[model samples]
Target: MAFEGLASKLQETIKKLKGKGKLSEKDIKEAMREVKLALLEADVNFKVVKNFVKDVSEKCLGNEVLESLTPGQQVIKIVNDELTKLMGESESKLELNSNGISVIMLVGLQGAGKTTMAGKLALKLRKDNKKPLLVACDVYRPAAIKQLQVVGKSIDIPVFTMGDQTSPVDIAKASIEHAKSIGCNVVIVDTAGRLHIDEELMDELKDIKEYVNPNEILLVVDSMTGQDAVNVAESFNSKLELSGVILTKLDGDTRGGAALSIRAMTEKPIKFVGMGEKMSDLETFYPERMASRILGMGDVLSLIEKAQEAIDEEKAQELGNRMLNQEFNFEDFLSMLEQMKNLGPLGKILEMMPGANAKELKDLDLSQGEKEMSKIESIIHSMTLEERRKPSIIIASPSRKKRIANGSGTSIQEVNKILKHYELMKKTMKNMKGMQKGMQKKMKKGLFGKLPF
Candidate 1:
């Protein structure tokens, strides 16, 4: 969503060459020119775009176009392939040792969401059955430790801290021992942050790292700082010898330069992304999925990955079939709604879409959404079991809407709108399901399917 305008422009510009029988050097040059302009307009690094365009032009011209492949198609493929590789060839993951408690040190500037990320990663690892101990190593600020404790408790994990007097290095060392005693398989040290990079801050972080000998050192950077973030990441990676990075504030209206530039500059695979303020907002980094999003094609891979990570796999598979059959009910609807919350806030999801602009979606904050969604959950909670399972009957009862509106502190119109939207979505799903089934039948008859050769 960060580069929506740029994505739309590039997609439209490339569509002109999609079905061409042949492409002259002039045509290729024109397309690259437009692409370079689009990237710069998106606030991407100017140098990066120049290099990207030059590389793409050389790769496409050097490639021998197959007789069956149009020159335009061949050029597009080369660009896509190179774009994917520029980000990284595959998904990057955090490495954890099963032999003992793996310690992870989190470092970054103030307001970069370093503490919040520590809790999010702890929760994510805990969900994977790894016992995680949250270390409150950011002791310079009085509330920093409290923040980690609060996040840890919300996710039912334990926080390791020793009031404010102890040095962070001491606290980190003690936390490792505490982790071993508590059977926690991982210890996450949430380190202190500064408003800007300074010698003292670097020395403080380095001291803690030396004292604890962490398995991984993650540099968290705010994506909204544009080129500054890439520079900050490079500096930290150079001084600390970081294992990887965590790009925070991705759900913000970022300029797209930082995310695109950091990877190229550091050559370090981004391990995770912090999309929102919630404890469950961290996600593994995937280059192919991000490339698709940047291209404005809709990132179905990341969407499905989020769903798979949050929902019960077997239950989700069953719900998938029911959606195809038009048999999905309010029960399934409630589950789906809850599932969205588990992935993170609704507004954050929209902001991450390749076509959604951060500025346009700035008002869609996660804190505001929590209150609104709680009200909806309360309304749903007030319903009787039978009423929830048979929502059509409840909507038909004129008095029920008024009762729910009052009970949930909402309006009658709100309830009606929700019901209407649900019905329309179900209808669309059924039609798509029918169309897919018909295509499958044709394919099985040997009269369909694209020829591989």
Candidate 2:
């Protein structure tokens, strides 16, 4: 959703090229012109867009593409490669000191969501088997320290605070000693922020940097600010020599200017991006995967990673076996539904799939789909344990269907539809089982002989 407008425009331009069997210079120029306009409309830096178009146009006109059998696909690959290079080319990992404690100081303007990112980073570190201590160095804003404490408590991590009476510089200096005593290997300092950049804010941040000698100084920025976010990163880099950047609010209706321009402008990699408001929504930045998503190629790797993190492998295997054996009842359906919900929103999952039409995705009413799932879940919940295990009983008894409808606040017709669908699924599974057996018999008869097992 971050680059909805830009992605749509770029995909449309590429689709035209893909339709052609041979690409002329005129076609490449027209496509590049459309791409240039799209990037400018998305609020990317003007100079960056100019250079990007010039480079892409030169490559498109080359013999390697113009003379190729699959010229259209070749052009798309060039664009994808250029886009990846424009962003960071690869993921940038955090610089963790394995020998001793590592300090990470977060700096940004007010409303950039630094405090929340601190907690997210700490939780991620804990999952990586590190003991993290959150230091509340933001003493200027009202309730800043309290907010950090609440975030740390929610994650079951320790927080170090010395109240508003102490200077942030001194607070950061002392938090390290506390971390050492508590055996914390990572120290995250949440520094103060101003509404705008000023000498006063820079001085305090620089002081903290000098005192702590932090291994990483990450600047958290709001991606929705467009070119303003780029300017903020430039100013901070000039002053503090920032190690990297973290873009927040990426899940919102942003034009994606900062994400596309920051690395080329500042020569710093984006370490992470805030995808949602949940504490677990922070994701490592992957430039190639993002370019693939923008070009409508999808990102299957990230989707697989999310599924691995959210679903239990044992439960998944058991459910698969049950479904193939035609033993999948309402109870298994309910369990499967819950597991799918853990992999984030349905819209996001759809976006990760290859060949998903952009216009169709935009027109889809995903909230309606969510409501339907809730309806199905409620209907399943209203059934008795025996009825769930053996759906035949519910189908045979009209009174039981009426009772379930009343309990779930639905009509009898809806209940009947669910029963019909379940029966259809079981029948399909049985057909699949028979087909598999037939294939095995054919293999034993030497029809397929000596498979590469």
Candidate 3:
């Protein structure tokens, strides 16, 4: 949804190469120019665009456009590969010392979700069987400590906070001591954010780093800030020698420039991304999947990776068989949705795609629907096992709809929509499976060819 515009644009461009027997110099040059303009219009960084286009040209030029392929696809593949390389080859992982307490210091600009990300990391660390303690080092923002407290409470993790009365350095030192006392192995210290580049903020962070001797110094940056974020990252790296970045607000209207430029600019790999404000919305950054999404190719790799991380292999295999057999139901739908949350927020997934801007995804704002989904899940959970296996039984029971709505804190209309969508998906998948072979090949070719005047 977020990538519809970008998808259309790229598809239009790639269409020209659909049936080409060979590519001339003119064809490659013209196509590359068009791609350059598109990237610029999409708000990609100027220098990044230049370097990317050049790299793609160098990699793809003079290569034969095979009899079965068009020249455009060759360029697209090159671009995708280079983009992946530019971001980083493998997924970055935050190091945690197993033998002793691992301290992480988080620094970022104001409103970059530093406090929320701290709690998310703590939750992830906890799930990994490590005893994680959250340190509230933000002695600046009045509500920052309370925000961390709420996040910590929701995740059931310990919060080491001194409120706004103490210095951040002192608080961080005390927090590490507290972690030792409590036998916690991980301490994620959430530090203060500044409005802009300021000595006070840097000095404060430097002091905290010196005192805590953190294992990881992660800089959280807003992806929507674009080039500004690159500048901030550069500054932070120069001052603190940051280990990595945590790109935040990626669910918003962002051009992806920050993600593309930060690594090249600061030489620090992005370890994670904060997709949403929810405690479960943080995710590990994967460059290849992101490259695929940006190129409008879809990211099946990320989907597979997420499934592996959150769902059992046997269960997922069973679900895949059910899908192939057109037996996907509400039960399967609920499981997939829950697994998706573990991957990252829905909005962030959309943003990772080329055409999935924030504006087109306005209707897909899941934050507001959190309560509704919870209720729907509860209502579904309350249904009899037989009813869940066979939704048709509930369809005949009109009173069942009202009962579920009331029990789940939703309206009858919401329940109906879910049921309708579920049925429609089943029917669609069934039809798709039986579709004619080579239909995709025919569809790839234009229905009409233009006349040469």
Task: Write candidate 3's Cα lDDT for 253-305 as tens digits.
Answer: 34566787788777899998776667766778888877777666666666665
In model 1, which residue pairs have backbone atoms overlapping below 3 Å? 1-353, 253-358
* Candidate 2 error regions (>4 Å): 437-453
Instruction: Specify the highest-lDDT model's number.
Output: 2
Estimated TM-score for each candidate: 0.78, 0.94, 0.74
Candidate 2 similarity to native, TM-score: 0.94
- Model 2's lDDT to the true fold? 0.92
Q: Pick by TM-score: which candidate is best?
A: 2
lDDT of 2 by residue, 332-435 (tens): 99999999988998888888888755666788999998998899999999999999999999999999999999999999999999999999999999999999
Return whichever of 2 and 3 wins on TM-score.
Answer: 2
Quickly count the clashes in candidate 1: 2
Candidate 1: C-alpha RMSD to true structure equals 6.9
Shift of residue 258 alpha carbon in model 2, Å: 0.8
